[model samples]
Target: MVAAVTGLGLGLAALGPGLAPGFVLSYDMVFVPDPAFTRMTFGLTGVVPRHVPSDAFVTALAAVIPADVVQKLVLLAVFVMACTSAASLVPSRRLLPRLATGVCYAWNPFVAERLLLGQWALLLGYAALPWVVAAAPRAHEPGGTRRLARALLPAAIGGFAALTVSALTAVTVALATRGERRPRVVRVVVTAGVLSLPWLVPGLLRPAGVPGDGTAVGLFAARADTPFGTLGSLLALGGVWNGETVPRSYGAPVTATIWLLVVVVALAAYWRWGQERRGAVIAAMVGFVVASLGAVSPGGLEAVIDLWPGFAVLRDGQQYVAPLAVVVAVGLGLAADRAAEARWPGVAAAAMAVPVFLLPTLAWGAAGDLRAVQYPDDWARARHIIDGDPAQGDVLVLPWASYRSYSWNHGRRVLDPLPRYLHRRVIVDDAVTVDGTTVAPEDPRAVRLAPAARTGAPPAVTLRDEGVRYVVVDAEPGTIRPSGAATAVLRGADLVVYRIDGAAEATGDQVPVAPVAAAWAVASLFVFWSFVAPRTTLSIPLLGSIKPRDPHRRRTP
Candidate 1:
């Protein structure tokens, strides 16, 4: 009964329509204006502004889906995740691994964020992770070739699909699932490589950005130069990154506790379970440790340098905690089953692990008064203010929007002062310094102004001079304060609307007011579906139910 309920709940949460209440007020509220989502959405939808360089892959994907279809896709992704998470609860082996997996699966802000918040493709990749780890040596028998081929084929197909959707999670699976079988591993690798041919071919052929090939590393270095205390909260590098220039750090207190429990469990396994099961324990431990480091580097100097080459490719170090949680769970589960004598040892160890896992989540909640609902009213108002005059091409980008401090709030065509692919006109280009040293658009790649000027002053007087019709300042306090000149021009109002004289009749520069309407349409559809045509009665075939590919599992030993 528990298994059935959990499976149903997982299906509802991840696959949608039938099991449990879906993620209510998370990413759906916060993501529309996120920089990453917006950028991807714009490109994917082929909504490129005039003259911006866009990748063909991005454009083609978006062009195929209408706004309504995208909403359904989002819902479908949530359903799939819910189902997977629910199903995760059914495989109870022992307390320590179960608790760890349960906690990691249920919480872990990054996974929650992706699953409930935004980036549906990332969610899809995460859902496929269980299949990746569960792969095993083929059952030996007459006609084994057919059985193995059938079993391996779907797993390979699923994994390849996961990689294409979310390469980060795919990479995580690849690294964690290695060494089970050399020949099996080789086959998995070959299949994944072939499947990834599309993305690889394009990446290899793409032209280089300015400031050379190591741009990502250079950017990491610049950010790492700040004091540890500041970067600690901002980047969470305490776990993953280690560089000669940047001080080495460890996980947050919560993560530390979790790791401590993991170590204890592994040690217990080694002492009690004999040396044969040791390989699995050790492999799991290694994966969990490395995964944790990516979140917040365990070591300092060496790890940071190692990350620069290709490891930094996983930018959010915290993401590792998710898979690490899974590894720890599965490892400890095996350990709990294999333990020789004491039930209390496993129980006690698990008890210790729970508090550690909860601390980080509690700390995050304690940081501020977090309101459950993020009102989209503010964004709507901002969009309305900008769209009030469609003929005015002079919309100023907020500093936060340009710098990626938040999600996609501004439209793709707005003239943001920050550097983005939007390609709209800007008064202060991300490349130009307060004192006029160039970064990307110009050669020097350095900003030479005083830090205060860099933070406060406008990039140039170009916006006012360039016939900007309207200036926008995000109402987020303290970050993007208006300069004295900007205040004078605003006549002491909190938000000042300016009319750039003699600007050519601006076209295609306004923020559309359709977001609220679009959101409402989606809400209405869901409501109708919920009340009138409830999906509870609807039945969709499960992949497992439709076919049992692993029929020879009984003979695998």
Candidate 2:
């Protein structure tokens, strides 16, 4: 029954509107920003974007569906993930102690808010994490080889699954969680090696690691310097801390209460179960904090440069939260499970666990509502402009308002977060440092700055003299409004598109030539084997011995 539900979750999610069971958001891989993965997948299947780690996967998947259709399907998948993760508590009903476990998963803000519409593979991979951890040996046994294999078999499979969503997360979690159980050192290493094989094999054959001209690394490395000790860390954990500066968004009175409920429940569970599961809880918390801080860590720049110089890696601090969210959710689930197993009635314990699952749904729904007000017209208007230009070539977008939204409206290519190898697009989205030092909207220090683009900077008559072909502004008039040498071509309430008469056109696109046929075929085979048929052998028993425990399973208070 439990297995059935698990399989059902996976199957149902996959069968949903998009046929892809991942997070749903307006961020499209193609069209809007730069053609990166979006174009490679939609335009020519023969060519793949070099920089984005998941280009092949997203492209192959997107090829089956039109880009516009994929966006809507992705939206449905996002909702399904939310509903399924939140409702995954049913099968554990008899195992009341473990009932709260599902709530820890379903109610998690990170799981609901971000995973619902953002990174799909991570969501699927994360769903498998708790089961894998719970199945791990608490101590070494004589059936050492078998036990070790048992543990790593699942870990490898789960890690590989995560790699498809975000390779870095897969690597981090695989490395961090290694040797946590009985330290069959050899087995641990082997497991990690195998788990990483899917990606490593393809990566080795590829000429470079992640694609891009390597300029993005400057922005990626700047995220490590955020100050450690501060109350502000909580909000920032979800990239939502800037209430005063960025304006409070993704919050609602009802959803806020649910978020509060989960926090309170987590605290309660922590207090209740601290005596026994403290180490696991602490480790999970550390991962969560580190990943969150790493995203905005300014201090990380020099460290990343020192450690991984030349490679435009580690630009995504938020990416760390992917697996960390799983660890923390698992920890919370375990904590909640332990608390429920105590003297409290199963009903009462379940009551406590219920909110953690619901908070995510409400919080995200609220966030969507909030974002609706902030960027409502932007999507439609952006779509209209992109549609107006029917050319198949790349189109530049300013102020970057949800690439997926624009892609849906206009089939044109864009240079979003992920850079394309085929349609090499110049992107200006830099990272925000820990101290909040980012390339300002109109900083003159940048070689690419133009006067109209620099209105956010000091009033410089010199800036207008610089050549800037297009200007997209979401701000109000007189704030950063265009003036000399630029004419407003299209204007919505807040969004305005301007054209520069004499500015030179930006350099042409730089698309990556496809890998050699043999290499591409081999890479595809490895991905298939790694993700599809990862498990070659199954334990003879197929199920573990049911070690019944005392209802009160702890020695500590």
lDDT of 1 by residue, 326-413 (tens): 3444444445444413555655355325533443332221121112222244444544544455554444544422233223322212
Relative to the unseen true structure, what is the Cα RMSD of model 1?
A: 12.3
Q: What is the alpha-carbon RMSD of candidate 2 to the true structure?
A: 10.8
Error (Å) of candidate 2 at residue 204 is 12
The worst-scoring run of ten residues by lDDT in candidate 1 lies at: 44-53
lDDT of 2: 0.38
| Leading candidate by TM-score | 2
Q: Which candidate achieves the best lDDT against the true structure?
A: 2
State in Å the error of residue 44, model 2: 12
Tens-digit per-residue lDDT, 1-557, candidate 2? 33334334533333243233222332222322222344333212112222233444444455676444454443334334333443342223434434344444444444443333344444444554433333232322333333333433322333333433333332233334434442433333443444444344434333333232223333432121123222223322343222211112334445545544555555565446444334333434444554444344545544654555323334333333444444334334545455445655655465545543344233433233212111235534654554454333232334432232332323222224323422322233332222344432211112244332334432223333333344555435234544555566667664565554444443322223343334345434533443455443323131123222344778586
Error of 1 at 446 (Å): 14
Question: lDDT per prediction?
Answer: 0.34, 0.38
